[model samples]
Target: MLLSVNNITIAFKSKKVVENLSFSVDRGQSLGIVGESGSGKSATALAIMGLLPPTGRVTEGTIELDGTDLLTLLRNQENYRGRKIGMIFQEPMSSLNPLFTCGYQIKETVLQHQAVTARQAEAQLTSLLEEVQLTRQLGERYPHQLSGGQLQRMMIAIALAGNPDLLIADEPTTALDVTVQAAILELLNKLRRSRNMALIFISHDLSVVRQVSDHLVVMYRGRCVESSSVAEVFSHPRHPYTRGLLACRPRPHLRLLYLPTVKDYMEERPDGTIVEKMPDNPLLGATRGSYSPSQFDPLLKVENLTVSYQNQINVLHSVSFEVFPGETLGIVGESGSGKTTIARTIVGLLPLKSGKIYFQNYLLGKARPRSVTRQIQMIFQDPQGSLNPRMTIGEALMEPLHIHRLYSSRSERRQAVIDLLTKVGLEPDILSFYPYAFSGGQKQRISIARALIVRPSLVIADEAVSALDVSVQAQVLNLLKSLQQQFNLTYLFISHDLAVVKFMSDRILVMYRGKIEEQGIADQIYQQPQSEYTKQLIQSIPQYV
Candidate 1:
């Protein structure tokens, strides 16, 4: 084995995070560690690299790379990290230093490990960028200037600067779009083959892991519940958790119900013990109900809308669509394809350069005296940025109600805030907490509650669930569906995830370069896409059997 993790255990402030987990990776082999968030995947990676945070410690374990024990290394052991193992972190934006250019960062990494001058390191940095399939010019840009995929490639370049024997990638492609994700995976595969390097691929997405890993380890609550070859494990999984994971993946051959949650498989045994079973939640199971067309009139309509920035570069060009009273219209396209511009224009946050917007048949233009902000709301992609950090959850939730004068008394508004919290599956006690106290999923749920508290007929969710884990995303999607049924709400769902778009949308609209390439019913569009862009989108989604 090129790398071996023998009976490892990790803890955080006296609480055990991972327990007695063992796995191995051979030269040129990929071992995937699959689990949900907080399942100890990142912690395990940190322990192996000897880079755990101050609060965390590897209580018991031995990490061996090529016959040497990494855990036994001294605190200031020279050349330990760079010469043996390397890591690619989960968030590229945060992992990279904002002040440094890509080339400078990679050069620093090379110089840190090797006795090389600045000129020698620069030449190596250019070669590293080419190895990762990035353009040489990208090396001159800062981290902020690069896209998510480019940043990730730069991260790989830095990690491979020392040419370690093993590469540990923790959710490396999480923030990238699907097409970019596929490209990155392909690049990683090629690099592994060329260098004969062992890989530890960690991610929550099983479908993504299956594409690159030869060996698979399924983790639950910090325990390794299943470990086997990727083909054997995915083809015929013995563990219930593994089966549940496989069943949750959105497949092209099957119609999706609600995604399978971990809670779905747990059962009480006759001996008063709980046991988990496989195939408890089937992907092809019948859903609660098919979406019915709304009886009410259209809530929001855009007729030949055109929007441009101050530079006169057209962002949205003659886009036309209508969101009915209780329907979901999913707009899908790559980055910078005018998705956010449409959402911003509809909420009156952006100035429309041309075309008309109608809310309940009332025109929306700069000439209008009244603000339609209350009836049409927007939930942004990043909840942390959208929400005020200093304000309590209650204060943020009450802003819309206060602006519209929805309540006569403060007591009534307080009760409404509690009700909204409960409606979105949060406790009333969370009202006093700040946005930073909550997880990504919780923040999004809070954002949803805030958007709906005003009783808006329309809600624009722009990549709302992109950052969430699969199980949490499933719950949030379910909440949105149920809320729509109860409130008769209309949604303008804007996302690049085609599976999600197919799952939630009544109608689908494919956009490319600020133009609508195709528009049709969800089923027909997904099954038999007429446009080339739509067809490419359907083909790009990762497949699961």
Candidate 2:
């Protein structure tokens, strides 16, 4: 075996995070670890790589590589980690040093592990970048200067610098578009095959795991409840959690009135067993529309929109779209395809170079009225970054109310915040808790509640559910749908995940290089794509089964 984890127990302050986890991978083989957030998937990876946090410790078990125990090597400073077991972290930005060039980092790794001179290290760096399909010119740029895909490729280059036998990737493609994710997965598979490197891929996307993995482990909390070949597991998931994950995926083919969630698939108890129930979503039928683009009365309209940055890069060009009242207009595209730029422009964050925006038949100027701004709320991609860490959830939700001067009294505002929390399926007491204390799903719900505090008519969800687990994504989506119906809210939903877009959108718009490649009803766009770009995007979506 290239790597073996035997009865490993990872803990923080004596609290077990991953207990008795065991898995093995041979050369050229891939093992996938999947579960929801807080399921200890990353913790197990960190334990294997000897990169756990300060308080975290392996209380039991042995991780062996080629008859050598890695724990002993860590104490000896033998450089076993980077040389023998390369790690690709969940977030490339944090894994990489922002100050150093990508090439410098790769070269440094090579020099540290191998007995290579400066010239040899430079040569190795060039070859490694080439292997990862990153150009030599891009190698000179800093981490922040590169796109998400480019940065991830750079991470791969660094991981391959030492020519390790085993590579571990943790949620490597979570933030990427489907096309970029496909390319990255293909590159990893190719490299693993050519170099005969064992791999451990951890992710919440079961479809992605099925593509890259030979064997699979389904984790719940800290326990590995199920293990088998990828084909066996996908065909017949024995564990309820595993079954839930597989069942909860938002299919691009059909617009399900209610998404089957983890809660729906499991019985609530000490140990959740298999069960079935439709989640409560009264707003779904109420908000649903069967109208065409021409039929929808424009609640918010954008015409001849063109935007540019200081570098003279045209992020958006002649883009036009209309979002009807009580409907979701989903925008799907790659990282630099102007999806976010469009949202920012609508929210009055970015300078409108040349365009006309109207809301409720009123023309919005560069300096939009406070009333106009209040009516249009935006939910950002990063829920963690969007909410203030210093403030409690209550304060965060109350800020919008205060800004708009809605309620006259503090008690009334507090009650309003509680009501908002209730609407989003959160406890009223949770308002006193900080944002960091909540999970990704909870934080996003908090963000949704914050957006709703102002009673906005139009809500711009910019990749809102991109950074979440499949089941959690379903919950947030259902909540959004329900809220849309109850409040009659118009959603300008933007995301890179076409599957997610298909589920949430009333109409779909495909963007490429700041231009709309295709626009139609969600069903038509997904089922019968006209544009080559749209087809490619759809084809790139990973298939688990």
TM-score of model number 2: 0.95
Per-residue lDDT of model 2, residues 1-545, tens digit only: 77889999989997898989999999999999999888899988888788788999899999898878887776753477888889898789998998899889989999989998999999998899889997899989999999999999999988888889999999999988899999999999999999999999999989999888999999988989899999999898887778778877877766677676777656656554435445454533232345455466699989999999984878899999888877789999998999999999888888888888889889888777889999999999999999899999888888878888999999999999888788899999897899889999989999999888899999999999999899899899889988988998889999999988988888999999999998989989998999999999999988755
- Give a tens-digit lDDT track for model 1, residues 62-133: 888788888787575446686668899999988999998988999999999888888999889889999998
lDDT of 2: 0.88
Off by over 4 Å in 1: 76-78, 116-119, 252-257, 267-274, 277-284, 287-297, 367-371
Off by over 4 Å in 2: 268-296
TM-score of every model versus the real structure: 0.93, 0.95
> How far out, in Å, is residue 47 in model 1?
1.1
lDDT values for all models: 0.85, 0.88
Tell me the deviation in Å of residue 439 in model 1: 2.2
- In terms of lDDT, model 1 sits at 0.85
